[model samples]
Target: MSLVSKFATVGGATLISRIFGFGREMLMASALGVGPVADAFNLAFRFPNLFRRLFAEGAFNAAFIPLFARALEEDGEEGAKRFASEIFSTLFSVLVVLTALAMIFMPALVTTIIAPGLAVCVDDPAAGGNALSCAMRFEITVTFSRIMFPYLACMSLMAMVCGILNAYRRFFAAAAAPTLLNFILIGVISYALWIEADKATIGFLMSWGVLVAGIAQLAMVTLAMRLAGFSVALKRPRWTKGLKRLLVLAGPAALIGGITQINLFVGQAIASFKPGAVSILQYADRPYQLPLGMVGVAIGVVLLPELARSLKAGRLAEAQHTQNRSLEFALFLTVPAAVALFIIPEPIIRVIYERGAFDPSATPAVAAVLGIYALGLPAFVMMKVFSPGYFAREDTKSPMIVTLVSAGINIVLSLVLFPILAEQGIAWATTLSGWLNAVLLFLGLWRKGLWEIDGKLVKRSLLVLVSALLMGGALIAMMWELNAWLQPGDAVTTQIAAIAILVAVAMAIYFALTLLTGAADRTMVMRLVKRKRG
Candidate 1:
């Protein structure tokens, strides 16, 4: 498939997943908001969710995709399938052990790393509010964490299946699988709400929903593999040559993949000290993640395998074109999203989340954090586009070192900023660290002469920025025009209409300027679409 087609396929599926994710979050806002139960749910979910992203989405794919793609290219189908099976066996064994051990020591993990402040709140009888309630919250968090930990194991295996499918050029099934999680969560949460279950009971049900979703996603992708004519069967663990090499690549990649998660860990740890900070960050984070996941994940998934294929075949120019275009595409989409979020965060937050327990008082804090996170959106998406250059060549150590430094910077900054700016400081730290990582990755790529932006790409990128700024200006003006309708006391319909108008206007202005300034590649997009349809 053409790059655009591949992106569209993955992007289309991701859009669905992101939409479902937004629905899930909207429900969460209404159901939990920023209360104690919400805090508990966020903390509990972050535990397994962190590891799942770190290993499944980050490390496993970084190491697995290039190697697996190369295997399929160089080896016959049998050889590739054999390699996949062996790697799967070893990975499953390891994840099983890790999940078991973590579950056994769930309490310690909660106290030491996940939510230290919750533990503090529980231990200090003199602390204000209900000590019993605080203790119950900690206990529920631990229970939910234990319930959700197995999801990491399932999802890591699911990611392996996805790597296999992506290498085989079967993108839709893998890309579509994540939406199942949202669907399941929405159902579980909605059902809980309909039955009027208590918050703790509802939290437990949602925790189980995570596991169910993991299982469903795994099954869906596993079936995709079989239908694609790939048999990825389990066998006794084997320490094969490919497995050893995978581990070598994965060692650094594990750290590289964990960088974002580690930053999140830092933010969550700091936020846990202040009640409701976790949920506030989570709510603020949800909207930004829509663009990030849609642009970043789609680009990352499609680009990595393509780069691996091109580089393995010694198509240096093709590899460079792929990198440049991917970067261009990311910026083209992400810049406007970042601008919009930065300019009108309050109305967006209020419209999407200011209902039920998410009162008007919560809007400003979440909006502030959302705006800060907006600054980092491009960097985060750029990292997704840039890191594949190193991974495709099996040179993970460079990105790993850069990720370690970026993570350290995030932690130190979060600590320093949390006291001064609260959760918004953590958001700033994430944004700054993302830029650090993106810059370092580019520097490494430059030093190695692996890639460079052509003059045209740079010019167009500048045009993209200019267009986005114009759109931002237009959006800000419209926001001013709709100020009364955008306020908290306005009817929900009015608030929604104001946001819809602002976004529609912003998009129209941005795209019109992009075409007029020659920032967009209309002919290329049309050709890709024609070829895809043909």
Candidate 2:
């Protein structure tokens, strides 16, 4: 499949998944506001998600795709299948053992990372309001972490299998697995909310839902693999040379790919000093992630295999062209998104949330963080697209070093900025660090002469930015009236109607401006559609 079509296939599925994720968080905000219970959920949830991103998405895919593609190239379809099956068996055994160990050592891990989750259980009566009174509270979340951490193992294994399928040029069902994960989480949370009347028990329900969803997600992907006639079966592990290379390459890629997550962890660590800070960051980051997940991640996920195949065929120029186009698209789409978030965060938050337990007071605080994060949205997405260039070459160490530098900046800034700027400061640090990562990668790629682009892509990108600026200006002006109409005294239905109208107006303006400015012309889009036979 062409990169554009593959991205569309994956991006469309990812959009649905992200929308569902938004709904899941909305339910969560209503159920668990920015408080101790919410903190616990974030802590327990981050536990697995942290590693899942590091392994499944980052390290595993980086190492797996190039090798898998090469296998398919040299050994034909059957040889590649066997290699995948063997890796699956080894990974499953290791993950099972690791998950078991995690169930036992949950307390120590929680204490080290998310000490704030234990607030309710700590000996100090007043500790529930403090993020750090976690001395004894870690024990409470251990059970939840135990249930949830296993989800990482399941997801990591699934990611490996998915990488195999993608290498074989199967994108639909595998990309759709996350949609299943989102659906399962939504269902579990909905059921939990339906049954639970007590506030405290809500956390338990959410945690349980997360555990069930992980299993469901694993099943969904495995079943898809089965139907594709490539289901991985259990086999014994051997110290194979190929596997060793993957391990060596992936170790640093995992860490490198995990820079954003690490930044998130640093935020969480700093957030440990203040109540509601973790939840605050989480809630604020939700809306912005929609575009990131839909666009940035979709491109990255699809790009790896495309680049892998190109590199396998020794089409360096073709790989460079694809990378540059992906970079341009990411920049064009995400820059506008960043501008919107930067310009009018309150209305966006208010429109989606700020109802039920999520009060008006929560709006400004969340919006502040949202604005800060949006600043680096384009760079963040571009980083996702560009990093795959190196990953496809099995040069993970370069990205790893870049990621380390970015991570260090985040850590230092989080500590320094947290007190001065409060929740948003850590967010700003993250934004700056993301751009720093992008800058380093861009320089690295250019220095290596890995990317050379034509003129049209650059023109389109500049046009996109100009259109985005105009759209942002329009939204900034329009939202003031929107906020007025959606004011507290207005009827709830009227507020909803006003929000709908504002959203319509903003989108129409952006699209119209995009057309006029030649940001997304029909001709360019059509060219993207016409598959360039590699």
lDDT winner among the candidates?
Answer: 1
Model 1, range 1-534, lDDT digits (tens) per residue?
Answer: 778778889988999999999899988888888888888888988888888777777877799998888788888888898999898888889998998999999999999999988888888857655788788878988999999989989999998999889888889999999999999999998999899887778889999999999999999999999999888778999878899899889888877766667787779988988888898899988899889888888998899899999999999999999999999999999999999999999888888887766777998999999999999999999998888899999999999899989998999999999989989989999999999999999999999899877987898999999999999989888888999998778899998888899988889999999988999997886776797899
Q: Which stretches of candidate 1 lie over 4 Å from their true place?
A: 127-129, 525-534
TM-score of each: 0.97, 0.93
Any residue pairs clashing in model 2, and if so which? 118-137
Cα lDDT listed for each candidate: 0.89, 0.79
Report lDDT (Cα) of residue 517, candidate 2.
72
CA-only RMSD, every prediction = 1.5, 3.1
Please write out the lDDT profile of model 2 over residues 1-534, one tens digit for every residue.
Answer: 566678778888888888988888888888777776777778778878889888777887788888888878899778787777777777888898988888887777776665543444354656544435464235446766777888898789878877877776777767777776667667766776788655457777777777777777778777777787776667888778777878898889888777778888779767866767888999988898888888887887889888888888888888888987788778767887788778867766776676666777888899899999999888888888888889998898888899999999998998899999888988999999999999999899889988786786889888888888888788767777677686766776777787678667877887777777777756755575574632
Instruction: Output the number of the TM-score-best candidate.
Output: 1
Q: Which stretches of candidate 2 lie over 4 Å from their true place?
A: 116-137, 524-534
